[model samples]
Target: MINLFHFVLILTLIVVVISVAKIKDLLSAVILFAVYNLIMSLLWQQMRAPDVAITEAALGAGVTTVLLVAAISKTGRLEK
Candidate 1:
């Protein structure tokens, strides 16, 4: 049986993924992508992979999000 916390995390991941794809603003999508990564890190921790979780949190949510945001700042935030 799936625990409530895990189920909620999975559901949040799904929602964030969809939101990232559907969002039109580049900044907003990047933020949602960061959220997705954070949730994925939590799920990885729940699955007993601390290393993977740490990597995801640091690289995916931290570095990648900052890079994308910086790129968006240079390129502009709108999709088109």
Candidate 2:
């Protein structure tokens, strides 16, 4: 069986990717990307890999989002 987490993860990934692609607003896209990372981290935990999940939760959901938001703020709100 694929399980609930796997199904949820796949669904979340699809939503995230679609949102990222369709959204014109940079901030919203970045936020969705962060959420995607969090979902992926949970999926990793479901697969029984604590270390990789921790790294993804920290790096992907934490640092990457901060950096991207900072970069976007610095650059400007308007997508250029």
Candidate 3:
């Protein structure tokens, strides 16, 4: 049986993925991508993969989000 916590995490991941794709603003999409990475990290941890979770949290949510945000700052936020 699927637990409520895992189900919620999975559901939130799906929502974030859709939001990232549907969002028009570059920064907003980056933020949503970071949120998606965070939820994925949590799910990985729940699956008993601490190393993968840590790597995803650090690289995906941390470095990648910062880099994307910086890129967006250099360019434009809107799609045009």
Top of the candidates by lDDT: 3
TM-score, cand. 3 vs. native: 0.96
Model 1 — TM-score against the truth? 0.96
lDDT of 3: 0.94
How well is each residue in 1-80 modelled by candidate 2, as lDDT tens digits?
A: 79876897889899898998888899999999999999889988988999999999999999999999999989976577
Poorly placed runs, candidate 3 (over 4 Å): none
Arranged by lDDT with the best first, the candidates are 3, 1, 2
In model 3, the Cα lDDT at residue 78 comes to 97
Ordered by TM-score, highest first, the candidates read 1, 3, 2
**Please, what's the RMSD in Å of model 2?**
1.2
- Evaluated at residue 73, the lDDT of candidate 3 is 86
- Candidate 1 lDDT by residue in tens digits, 1-80: 68999999999999999999998988889989999999999999999999999999999999999999889888877988
CA shift of 27, model 1, Å: 0.4
Over 4 Å off, model 1: none
| Candidate number with the higher lDDT (1 or 3) | 3
Clashes of each: 0, 0, 0
lDDT tens per residue, model 3, 2-66: 79999999999999999998989888899899999999999999999999999999999999998
Q: At residue 28, give the lDDT of candidate 3.
A: 86
Q: In the order shown, what is each candidate's alpha-carbon RMSD? A: 0.7, 1.2, 0.8
